[model samples]
Target: MAKNKSKKKYISGSLLFLLAFCFYMVFGPGRHRHQPKRQDTEIKNNEAKSSKDNTPLRELTTFTGKVTAIKDGDTFEVLFDGQPEKVRLADIDCPEKSQAFGKNAKQYASDLCFGKEVTVISTGKRDRYKRVVGTIITADSINVNREMIKAGYAWHYKQYSKSKELSQIEDEAREAHAGLWADAHAQAPWEWRKEKRTKKQQVSNQ
Candidate 1:
């Protein structure tokens, strides 16, 4: 009778141990491990959102407007928010109206953007002429500044911009002898302006 009692006590203790182990596995350290993984995923998602929000272009206030005038290959007037605003295409300089291919460049710009809705991305900075210095994206998702360089209608304006993509496209255009690149001695707009200024200074001094 004592041996039977001993066996009964041993079985009861074993059953209690199994039950405690199962309870711990369901609601203890094992369950808590999954919590850290979920927290890590949340952190990563927030970080990605923060990075996207901090993008340079995203930080600039975007303006939607319609192109009312193509002043040149690299400049235009826009009807924005019911007001007319002149915009100088950033990172490019087109020929003067008197320069070779100047008319062709203006015609190309007019064809691409005149009467089309465009989005202006600016840093809220204006040029000496009070024109907004910005990048333009047409309704068809065309980048007007880059397209001008690629078509050889404008120079990359490296003195004002350090865009490698613009430089690359300009090089390709030159290699293909597209538009202004067909002329072996195409003068940059800045150089042309400087020459004109020098001539004016000389005439004034005389």
Candidate 2:
């Protein structure tokens, strides 16, 4: 009877050890092998949420501001969010101050936008002068940049822009001999700048 009791006790102890091992395998550190996949899924979800939250600002393509100063025909300063920002009209180049019809272009820009609330449609770009380049829309929804080109106050600036609509308007203005186009020798602003630079170079060489 003693030997049988001892044998039974040994079998009971072995069974308990087997049960413990099985329990550990199912619910202990060994079970954590699958946890890394869950953690990875959570991390990806967080990143996706962050990206969604930032989408609006990243896709920001337009803003509204008041035109505080008309620097020239194709450049101006705007009061946006209580700060002055310089803006350059995209896709067009206006006459320089020294060129013919330059003052008229400035005046026209001022008459159209100065001190008025305007909308700027950013082309996701900037100029070499660090000016924000975009299309300026006046209070009456007139596209100031395209209007300037249509009025012959500015050139289409094909070197920088390939807008077919702007090109068509420029053609119409030229055909009608409107504004600066009325002059038989109206020169493009880029050409005028190049000529000025060449003249300066020649003088410096002398």
Candidate 3:
């Protein structure tokens, strides 16, 4: 009788240990798998937040200000809220001050808006130099950006603008041999800047 009782007790203990091992094998890995999924979700949310923070916020902005200074054919300074804010003409790129017809483009812009109260309709985009990109409307209700293209002093800047009116104006100017169009080979401002950078790099290499 004593031997039988000992044998029964040993069998019961062995059964309990087997049940515990099975339970752990079923639940342990499942719990660990869920932990990684939660971590992945948190990481994705953080990445989305970081991307939003890095992007620039843009809106339409308008203001009326006096043309305080003319920087070039496509840029100028406007007095707004008692400060001179630099404004870049949207949808156009003009010749650099050193390029052919560059001086003429600057003079044309000055004649159109210098010392005049102009309305600026900005796309609220800032260039690398942080100048407001926009259109300038003179007190006489003239669209200065359109006039620049109409006179062939500025390129339509198709990469940034898709205005058909501007495209047509540029075509008319080119056909009439107006302003810079008079030259048989008028290079775009972007190409001109690229050439200058290449030349500078070559000089530095020397």
Candidate 4:
């Protein structure tokens, strides 16, 4: 019985060692386990948090509205919930004001939401600007974010996207070379803003 117990103990130790070895190999704790911080990574994380904070909690209501107007790729004010409220779609980013396709992005959004009563879902909070940030869906289950990308009018803002559904659609849009994908390296609206701020700071310092 003692011998049997010894064998079991040996097996358990071996298994644990094997697991530890595998983990190290996979995650690379071999020599340098530290990863340097990257500006891109930092920007992505910030955008992600902003995206999370911008998603609605649980659409408090489902209503319809004629897109009285489209503000940009991510904003629109419709006669929704019996009152006109500006909405910013959650989890997607579009071109910046000075970027190529910026106008196209806004126009595409207008085309999709301008005359429709979209079903909005909550995941986050309204901005200080009072834009209800949420996912908008058509009665036909059409995702407005995807529609923008699929239509070749936008890019999938993976930096801010947390929804698996949106990610997949965005991936498809990329694979298919739709919209902003036409540009080899289209700068995201958020990133552009960040760059602009940095440039302004540099100029001020100089």
TM-score of each: 0.70, 0.70, 0.71, 0.62
User: Model-by-model lDDT, in order?
Assistant: 0.90, 0.90, 0.93, 0.74
- Residue 55 of model 1: what lDDT? 52
| lDDT, candidate 4, 69-128, per-residue tens | 787887877676566777777777777646788888888787666788777776446767
Worst 10 residues of 4 by lDDT: 29-38
lDDT of 3 by residue, 91-117 (tens): 999999999989999999999999999
What range of 10 consecutive residues in model 3 has the weakest lDDT sum? Answer: 52-61
Q: Model 1: residues >4 Å from true position, as ranges?
A: 1-60
Better-scoring candidate (lDDT), 2 or 4: 2
Q: What's the true lDDT of residue 123 in model 2?
A: 67
lDDT of 1 by residue, 169-195 (tens): 999999999999999999998999999
Query: Residue pairs in steric clash, candidate 3?
Result: none
Model 4 pairs whose backbones collide? 55-123, 55-124, 56-122, 56-123, 56-124, 57-123, 57-124, 59-122, 152-179
lDDT per residue, candidate 2, 105-192, as tens digits?
Answer: 9999998999999999996676677678899999899999999988889999999899999999999999999899999899999999
RMSD of each: 18.4, 13.6, 11.0, 21.4
Clashing pairs in 2: none
